[model samples]
Target: MDFNFTEEQDMVRDGLSRMVREQYGPEERRQLIASDAGWSKAIWGQLAELGILGMSFSEEDGGFGGGAIDSMVIMEEFGKGLVVEPFVPTVVCAGGFLKHAGTAAQKEEHIGGIVSGERVFAFAYAEPRGRYDLANIETTAKKDGGDYVLNGHKAVVIGAPWASHLVVTARTGGERTDAQGISVFVVDKSADGIVTRDYATVDGRRASEVYFENVRVPADALIGEEGNALPLIERVTDEAIAAQCAEACGAMKVAHAMTLDYAKQRKQFGVPIASFQVLQHRMVDMYTEYECSVSMTYLATLRLDADERTRKEAVSAAKVRVAQAAHHVGQEAIQIHGGNGMTDEYAIGHYFKRLTIFDSEFGNIDHHMKRHIALAS
Candidate 1:
């Protein structure tokens, strides 16, 4: 099959690339990260104006009718910039849920806002005790008359500080960790009984430990069926895995390039280190790892619309490969750069930190490996 991007996709990629380059230089990025909001709303609005936020939704849903590939394209570019915008949470995760299972009213109310970038969303799924398991939810949503009272803590909620809304997962029927009882809802972040303690993440992004204390949401907030949301969650998260795998690929590509540049410049024994075959070999390995990761990301992206088993296998395989590649590429880059790579002033260090965090998001190498093995068995 042909791997070439369509003209529109190319335009999208080029447009986003220019945006990142023009907007997020190293110094600019630091300022944005150090700001009180930890991200740039101006850039967010620019993305909306560029139609990127609406790229994945259907025209009927007020989007550009793009799909997994569009997200892959956008995220890879975001990775290159170390963008802290919540695209994955707002567009990929929340929009995926609305696209796949949301009621008509839900879509009408949310998708337009999402496409316009007026309603920012963070996915509140990872509980304190949940370690990469989508079903391992301890957050509870007890049903009351025409509403649900939520009570739980969502840990490491990326982009929660900037989100106007949250796509949250909670148990509404069965016991904890039970697959059948897990449900998803779209909650207002400013709702009463909801509290957030925000912090800057190591990757220069902002995140929050979100607490829900008897937070009441109308029944209309529920996204899918009352007690059958695990499959929906799995499918959306697999899509997220694929998107992030693409992101890792972008970071790895940049990291490898930085290492190559550094090796060519930094003199050792009165000669550039790039001339050393041992160091050259290590850089070559990093490039190889990056190319392989891009291939795996493509595999996962293409398989998103496949059958559940096939999609899971492909996503798991990509996540495992991408995670390992991110780790190797990052560590090798650091070692090659010596002390310069360890400092906060260097761009390489920031890239390394993002790659390190990428491994843990959605699933790590071992987590995907085990998931792939279980599916194969």
Candidate 2:
């Protein structure tokens, strides 16, 4: 199979690369992170104008009809820049759910805002006790006269503080861990009885702990058939896992390159460290891990449209491999940079922080390993 990108995809990648290189230097990134919103609205608008935000959805949904590969390209570039934008939460997670499970009218109502960057979105699914289980939801949405009243707490909702809308999961029927009786609902972030406590994440992004105390939403707020959203949730979560792995691959590439550059410049014992054979071997190991990660990410991207079992297995495998690479590449990058790598002023440390966070998002290495084993056996 040809892993080569199409001309359009290449253009997209090049365009984003140029945007980040020219507009998002380390100091500029710091300023953006320190800003009240914790991200750059100008850059967000630029992405919308460039059509990057719409690249992952279908034309009927007012997008470019691009799929997993499109998201892979955009996210990898974003990773290289340490972009603090909510693209993953807004476009990948929430938009993926909308595209896969939303009704035509629902798609028409919300997708344009995402494509135009006029509205930010977030997926509020992770509960305080969920621990990577999609079905482990304690949030409940009880029917109440043409509406549903939601009540529960969502933990670490990335981008929620800035999001105008949220796609939330709630239990409508059975127990917390049951596959059935789960549903997805879209709620306005400013709705009555909704509360959020926002904070800056370690990786320079913003997330919030949101609470719903009898939050009421109209009947039209439901995304798909009630009590049957787990499959859609699972499929979209796998896509998110694949997208994040690709992002890690991009970060790993940058980390490896930066470490090599540092080795060439920093002298030790009156000689450049790159000249040391032992250090060279370590850099080589980092490069090998990066290469393997990229290959696995590509494989997972291609398998997104495969059968459910195959897709899940491929995604899990890629997540596990990429998680390992994140650790190895990040640590080696830090080691090569010495104590300077630990400081917030340097870019290397930020990359390492992002990689560390990437290890836990969606699923960690051990989590994916267990998932792959369960599916295979």
Q: Model 1: which ten-residue window has the lowest total lDDT?
A: 172-181
* C-alpha TM-score for every candidate: 0.99, 0.99
Candidate 2 has its poorest 10 consecutive residues by lDDT at 359-368
Per-model C-alpha lDDT, please?
A: 0.93, 0.92
Q: What does the lDDT come to for candidate 1?
A: 0.93
- Candidate 1: list runs displaced more than 4 Å: none
Q: How well is each residue in 68-141 modelled by candidate 1, as lDDT tens digits? A: 99999999999888888999999999999999999889999999998888999999999878988999998999
Superposition TM-score, candidate 1 onto the true structure:
0.99
lDDT of 2 at 34: 91
* Clashing pairs counted in every model: 0, 0
Model 2 ranges with Cα > 4 A deviation: none
Model 1 / residue 116 / CA error / Å:
1.2
User: How far off is residue 202 in model 2, in Å?
Assistant: 0.8
Clashing pairs in 2: none
